[model samples]
Target: MNWYVVYTKPKWEKKVAERLNAIGVVAYCPLITKESQWSDRKKMVQVPLFNSYVFVQIEEKERNRIFEVVGAVRYLFWLGKPALVKDSEIEAIRSWLSVPETYEVAAEQWKKGDKIVLESGPFSSQSAVIQEVKKNHYVLILESLGCVLKVNKKEI
Candidate 1:
């Protein structure tokens, strides 16, 4: 068996998967829920990670029969031949993106114009507003203005 990419109409991946399954064609569509908020309201919706694409697992002989399905517009290929995506790679990404793992990102401080100074560190002499703070050290967004920069814990 091999996997082939199928391009479906917009927002129709689930529908295509359902159709394929009913016809005994194996299909995989990984979905994720995303939240969006605006001044009016907030909504949570399910969206496919790979837009307009669905992966189908099928026998070599079923190729022609599967192609006739509606919304199974075309196969993703390279050099005029269908490209097969490894199941291991797909599974790896699925596991990696899963929320079971724990990760912590420290909060950021200081805007572009805010004054900053490193209270105690090798970079003490330099001062800059916290453009962005990663594991440690501020990006110094306003370094161009040349202000007295101090990267204190409070301004980090």
Candidate 2:
């Protein structure tokens, strides 16, 4: 059997994955624990790392049955056929999430000249290079516009 990508309804990845597993479909929904904060307190929440995507190990014959599950929209197709995910890629995700702290810290260990991409907000989709790293802020040089800006660690 090969791993295929399944697109689920918005915010239904975990729920869809549970239903798939109960029906004997081997589904993998990768999650990441993020520190969420309200005014009073902070807590960690397990959120789907890939948002609406889930991986299912199955044969091509089982496609129709898999799509019958609630919230399962369809398989991700590439060039008119269902895309297959490599086993090594799945294992890499598992190993990375196994030691989540290491991954978080490694992202923060930015050295000068390291390339970084803005993940969200107004400056999103913009690529910048590290000019310097301060206590908790990064000085990035937006080369395309010839601008230097200070951004918080979380912004990247």
Candidate 3:
């Protein structure tokens, strides 16, 4: 079996993964936990690493079965075929999610005013400029959208 990417309804990655797994499909939806702060309290929440996408390992003959699951919209086709993801890439995602401390080291080198792209979370693939760097976090400006975001250091 090989891994293929599936497009899902917005904010439905977790649901699709769960449904696929319930049907005996090996599904993966990478997630990261981040602390969200409000005026009075802070709490950690699990958020999907990639929005609207899930990975499933299955034989080609099982494609129809996967598509029948609700929230699973379509395959991420490349050159007229479903794109295959290598095991190494999936393993890398697993490793990254498993270790939360490694993010500090990876994020330490970015300087102020540096151009950064969000690889995960709600802003996945969105470009932003680093406005300020604080301990384990960054103040970023999404110039295109005229919005400011405070993101975990590791997530940028």
Which numbered prediction scores highest in lDDT against the true structure?
Answer: 3
lDDT by residue (71-109, candidate 3, tens digit) is 999999999999999997798678657754433324677
Candidate 3: lDDT over CA atoms?
Answer: 0.85
lDDT of 2 by residue, 1-156 (tens): 899999999999999999999999999999989999999999999999998999999988887777768999999999999999989779867865775252122247788999988655444557899998887777899886578977666535
Steric clashes per prediction: 9, 0, 0
User: Against the true structure, whose TM-score is highest?
Assistant: 2
The candidate, 1 or 2, that scores higher on TM-score is 2
Q: What are the lDDT figures for the candidates, one per model?
A: 0.67, 0.83, 0.85
| Candidate 3 local lDDT, residue 68 | 72
- TM per candidate comes to 0.61, 0.65, 0.63
lDDT (Cα) of model 2 = 0.83
Off by over 4 Å in 1: 37-40, 105-156
Candidate 1: give its CA RMSD in angstroms: 11.6
